[model samples]
Target chain A: MKMLRNLLCSAALASLTATGAMADGHGWSLKKAAAPYAGTTVDVVFLLRPGYEAIEAMLPAFEEETGININIIKHPYENALGEQVRDFVAGGDLDIALIDLVWIGNFAENDWILPLADVQAKYPDAVDPKLDMDDFFPLVLNAFGGWNDTVYGLPFDNYSGLMFYNRCMLEEAGFDGPPATWQELKDVYGPALTKNGKYAFALQSKRNETQSADSFARVLWPFGGSFLDANFKSNLNSAESQAGLKFRQDLMQYMPDGIVAFDHAETVNGFSQGDIAIITEWSAFYSSVVSPDTSKVADCVEIAPEPMGPAGRKPALGGFSLAVASQADEAEQAAAYLFIQWATSKANAREYLERGGVPARQSVYEGDDLEAFKFVPALVESWQDGVPEFRPRFAEWPEITEIVQEWGTKMMLGDVTTEEGATEIGTRMESVLEEAGYYSGEKPLAQ
Target chain B: MRGQVSRKTIFAFVGPAVIGLAAVGIAPLIYAVWTSLHFYNLTKLKKVKFIGFENYSTVLTDEVFWQAMGRTFFLLVTALPLQIILGMSIALVLHQPGLTLIKTLCRLSLVLPMATTYAVVGLLGQVMFNQKFGVMNQLLGGADINWIGDPENAFAMIVFWDVWQWTPFVALVLLAGLTMVPGEVEEAARLETKSKWTVLRYVQMPFLLPGLVAVLILRTADTLKLFDMVFTLTRGGPGSSTEFISLMIQRVGFRGFDQGLASAQAIILLIITIILAQIYIRVFYKEV
Candidate 1:
């Protein structure tokens, strides 16, 4: 029944995409529109991740369609923001700014990336009227790129956190299915599964962005918590927030011994090595989890939407956007914009998904091979509703995130009580926001 | 001609070195001092302005800054003594007569850890010290030590790795200093004082003092500025338990883009390093 439904959906999606593809020729299809900037070189920094590698796989066609050379510079996820920031400050040769969702405010406020409207006006030929910005998943599009009702970037490589679990491991532990809720995972599966020196789950709680995004902020929303209230005051001290954190503290027992130091790589490797049964990881890691080379139990891995919390399911949201660099000259900017439009276009979403790229286009999800990639259904659902400001996409968030990373890790390590940690974070976070002029109205609220 | 010093000749000989020093050292120092006084956040470049020692004031009162200082002090005190003692013991054994081949072999062995890069040593620490899968746990018959996750263990692992990597260099330095001792002076001391301890204290201590001072100065600077190893190893983590002054400053300046605050913190660190170095020199002189 599922296969038949997918087949029918694929057919309907094909016609919709065909209609969208044909409409592309009238506005800014790469083959014709990119002709003027054919020889131009578009320099962009790409992180060494599955999504970026997937994009790289689909790049040859992009290059062929438009005679543009993408001068790809690779950086690790931890360092890419710094590298891009330095390049922007120095007026270096990055034509396209690869922006982490958290960095959108920083880059946009700094006027480092050309706003979508500004870029369209500046480079008319590169503007895709038929590109249909509305086609982008509203949550992802806004979160990854939007700033103060202005879109600065198009959602490109995206992530929605999902539960990747080993079905075999769960079955062996005498549980027939994955946990349906966070509470269930702790109260039921955790005790049943975490035996024989193996862990039931792992949270990538390493200090840095991982601790902030993957571990710390991940819990808040589902438990009816958030970093800041509607008035922009620190919301971490609320009982709801503390409950979420306290729950995480309790869940730590089922995790690996040194999990407080584990990052996404470590957690994924743990799942791969059969050391852990389940992990709530980004959907972008689907390729790695399924690959025979990286995973020993590749065949047994199953992915589902992150389990429910007291309130509901709100999973981790993280990814980057691509925008034309403000530093780029008109020609390079046009080429960069052209590339962004082409790569993220609805016409190209199918190949992108097939290769490995996690496209944010709503129309693309219904296309073929939805079942093959087990994470996509979970991804679509998780991404259906998301916290756009999961980590608080404000210019001051970088500084505040450091505070969160510090206190969040301390909380996990038992250095500070959950309430104490939350209180500290709230105090420090308010200080940062106050400095950034959030309280004084020097700067308005950022998403 | 031999006694007379020509100014032009002196300038010609010293000009390149002076120019190089001024360009690399003096210029950056001036810039840092200037930056330290301002509200110079890199992200808010347009808003950067002269705030007049406000950054310094912030640094002085900052709790995190002091915590980092405390951690740095702990690491330095923990690692340096171990390195010095181990190096001294290894150096003394190597200094014994008729152990030329042993000395050569020991020196060769010393190069291995020193030659490995700081970042790689940090990575090696992770591979070895990992609780579940690391070699250290396996070797210890499944000892469940959260070497990187636990606060105290993480710091201790750093100290352990620090001693492992740097002890070799310390031993080599002391051995070279020991070699500078005259063979006859050593033999005479040994013969006169039946106690090896007395001979080492009175005779060998004099020569080793210079080397020891050098080690103290170098290691003081090295430990204070330690970044890469900790960055790759624990990242000042298990909740900033191992974050040193240098790591904190880098995050402030580079990651947080608060250049002014970082500069102010750096200047403070510089003063602290100078004070520590002075104390070392004065204490060593008193001992001598």
Candidate 2:
């Protein structure tokens, strides 16, 4: 398993193989890869988030440049997975598959998406010369697209959780900047910031992926905890995990009331409206909170890498990859690959970043030499040693996430003790992993 | 020859209906049962196989399933009576004579909530019941009550939404029933007893029975399968405090990708619903 992981890690640089060898039109051109498929249309699900909106803004240029009509199906984040699953299961007209980090296992294991090798083998001439995986951060590339030593997607909208704090609020509370660590946030800043019905922090603990990724897993890793152990057993009840959770419960009095029901929108809104001092959210939502039109305190908002813990800074990782759906016809698949490649290409990374997207390209971050984007430095810092398996990249994760949302909320609501919540979640997670042959010799510990 | 001719005519007449029923209804039920008997998960298609009764047993024993069932029953028991009582009272008030213009306007206003879409109602609930910026908190002098975040309060809000949205429809149904009472009989009852309660109990109550039965059956079934409103509102949140059986089935099927377990749960819910319907007919339903 270590050797396989090493191989996967090395494969992250496979795209760099073409760094020097390139034709005209910015090393690789859509004119070459997508010219033949001029009229071909590639349909994909574009979520209603800022990242997808940025991608959508470039579609017109893409159509004009390559003549490959990108047909986008708009869906809310909550509904995108279900739509993608339905499309994949039914072999629908969808040409591109958006694989969330956690869904890499389900999509790849089911062959719902075509691996990069398959795409290259089928369309060598159409494959870009500069489509280097090395350009992407290994963490983002591997988590979003890679599974079982194979690449199935290109990182489109990758994220690392960062602290979006109100500097004015912090200053008002006699602080110069955001807290450097979770301990400081609780012991020092929490008391100062939380006053007059306002809160020091807002976590999106809604009973959905928000609770699972943003609330549950976000706390676990920083405190030296994880969802599973070395043998894929439940590690949720570990002392580290319970400490993290207990810390959360202790900090509850400092948060706004009804925080257990807050989703991403609510949490972000609370921060933007200046009701909360801090919010730990994905980088993808930066544009919304920073924009003057959307945020009441846009000027006061500051970006920082997530607060540290005993285990160090393990920021929550979440994002999606754009891959060619296996169900599409050969020509459509090629066209789909062309569109995704053009969208995430190193050449377009700057433009993608400019349009409110958190691009995964290292070159893009490097090109911003002046450091205009506030979150870029923080992103680099977090992705340097972030947890790749922040949430288990397995088919059973959705089930396990649902379980977490349930018990995690109950724990927050004080209906269940932290031990009880952890035990319940651990037992359920073990049952799921066991059913998936993790206990038997059939499956390897993918970590 | 006559017997043969009659047999052919009967076959021609009834065959289309039977085929249509089988195609539209029975076939899907059978297919669902077949699916329930297997270890079918869309993600693990390769592992699909017949695992008869295993899914059923799992669902039957699952704590989430039981909790969802209990919450759903709680909503039904609580929401139905409130809707019925409020509905009947409003119907009775409107049944009185005079104030024609006022009565007509009030009746029109009652249909407003029912007219709005179910999903929208859920969205409205989310916005209105929000902790910080919600109108509900703002109305109470900007109180910081944790409305939907608390389990019991969240459940109560869901029930309140159901009653608020559906009581009008029930009132409309009962109003139609009240209008059917004979004018002469009501006048005679009024003349015999100067008590309006007596006239309502004896003269109009009989006419309301059929409408009452219809409301009970429809509401019961609707409550059992209510998805859109609650899904939009809380999504069975704050630790499954507001999770209904439909939401539970959805979680099993859609989120877990375990069609077999979802199907088994559906089947169990179906049996429960049918039994409840029977009980409603036996108790509240009358020949009148």
Candidate 3:
């Protein structure tokens, strides 16, 4: 009976797609204009995530309607960028790729991924008119998609860093809510919450981009510090940055002993295992935190907007965008663009959200389904207030990230003073940028 | 005459190996040297151009590269001698002419560490050497020691982990070498010498020298290129204290996307390894 129903649905979708009319039954459909490219196969490579798994589950429906075979390739998060870069370098046939926002400048400047404007210009009907570009959060749309006035990708997955706290632990510590500011967190909540083998906090400080950009920037921005000054000079050694580093060092006393080596896995697992009281983590971890199999504090965990920093509240923004590959042939590019459009459209956004995907659509956040998840309000608030450029999003970010990770980690471990670390990072970053032709005074900071 | 090979026979025996070596080893080395002379970056493919030893000059002057070289040398110097002592001691104990069951059990246990992959050992070290909840601290009556959090302790833990994983292989090799030492020669030396130490010093030490040299050469080469253990264990932390030369090359190549610099660093590492191997051959394997 299910097979017959599916066949009927597929046949109806095919007819609707062929007739150049919108399919209204399921409230979502591939553009009828995409019929010309029906038989094209688009190969997409992305990092494995729960949201991607949801998209994989919806592949059959998409395939049946569009008559396009979707070949999904997943790589581990750590190696995904390298794999994509290598693929682009070799001109391998990849139709679509999930690109990290930090990689936008690199991919765009190098012309690795097709500019969406060019795709739209070449194929007039590539993007559906009904696909409301205004529905996505402006911050996310600009951060993930727009690069130097050109849209390179569509924002697919969105993340905002939030403080996930153990409600039970906080209650036991005589607090009704999570800390509102960094000072309260350090002076009051951290000490009170730490007890009986449970640490007050877990941080993602492992010596990588996570430590330098995601975890460290969460504090740096709140302390009113930026990676670069207004003139594109390294400002890491500023007083605000030093104070933030010192605060992080002091907070270590209430954390796990080897907190310096903790990464996303350790931080998330520590919280899940009830060994950590609070963690500032990406909103995408909502599914894992609420899952019964993975989390011990599923019932007691609560999400809150990032604690106030000295400068103000600035949440860490981390996520990826789905972009069409320039190396792909014309038909594949159109097919990929259609897929990106439909996947991020309002009609499909709610469904994607229900299936553990975090959509960037603002309408979805304002919908009735907002009441379904406990973290939605806080997550939405973070999205509205977060600073996407807390870490520089440029082609040379990967190199700069290494310098930050090296010196920032040293400062965190007390092996180097904050001033020394900042100086070293600034000097090394200047050299790296100079070698890349940034300081020549002729070229802009990014090509 | 029977053992002497014709040209075709020689080709039959060595042709596949020669092809394999050219494809896997020689090709990559040549390509690395070629790349080292250019300003090639994977991210900036369009900007690739030949720059003539600029990358080599950059590497030679880079302080991080020199620090990494110093750390690699420190690790090699510290771990090799300790590994040799531990291996020889175990080999001597296992070669004793009694307690067959104990010998069998010891031999089986010796293979255990050698059997496990170094990557797995590195990961296990992370859990076991964790400062807070690790089994090592738990076993030490909950004493607080920052094994991977402190720069010194992290470096020590890396050395200790390498020693633990490789000492067994060294022991097994030395045990095989010890067996090849004839019993009659040792007994004759024992009869002629006034002390057991004198017999071992004269008879057994000479027999073990060639195998010792081989083990030293292999371990030195392996340790020089050590990456997986460091990558999985501490990621060259805290603050690059445990960063090995290979890790630096990887960071420069993959993360920094500077293929030219990485290739230059790799070529320098290769030259250093060759020089060390020659020294070992000259000093220990004079017969060769």
Where is the poorest 10-residue window by lDDT in model 2 chain B?
B1-10
Q: Model 2, range A1-447, lDDT digits (tens) per residue?
A: 453465455554444333332433354566866778999988999988998989889889889988888888998887888788877888799999998899989998889998886776677667677777677887787888888778888889889999999999998888998999998988998889888878999888999999989998988999999998898888888999999999889878788777888888889988888999998999998999889999999898889999999999999998999998999998899899888888898988888888898889998887637355889889899888788789999888878888998899999989899999999999988888889998996888877
lDDT of 3 at B50: 97
DockQ value of candidate 1: 0.73
C-alpha lDDT values of all predictions: 0.87, 0.87, 0.82
**Candidate 3 chain A, poorest ten consecutive residues by summed lDDT:** A18-27
Prediction RMSDs, each to the true structure: 4.8, 2.5, 6.5
Give the TM-score, chain B only, in order for the candidates: 0.96, 0.91, 0.95
**Can you write out model 1's per-residue Cα lDDT over B25-47, one digit (the tens) per residue?**
99998899999999988888988
Q: Which is the winner by lDDT between candidate 2 and candidate 3?
A: 2
lDDT of 1 by residue, A71-90 (tens): 99999988898888888988
Which candidate would rank higher by lDDT, 1 or 2? 2
Badly placed stretches (over 4 Å) of model 1 are: A1-29, A128-130, B1-5, B286-288
How many clashing residue pairs appear in each of the predictions shown?
Answer: 0, 2, 0
Clashing pairs in 2: A15-A132, A15-A133
DockQ of each: 0.73, 0.77, 0.73
Better of 2 and 3 by DockQ: 2
- Looking at model 2 chain A, report the run of 10 residues with the lowest lDDT sum: A16-25
lDDT of 2 at A190: 88
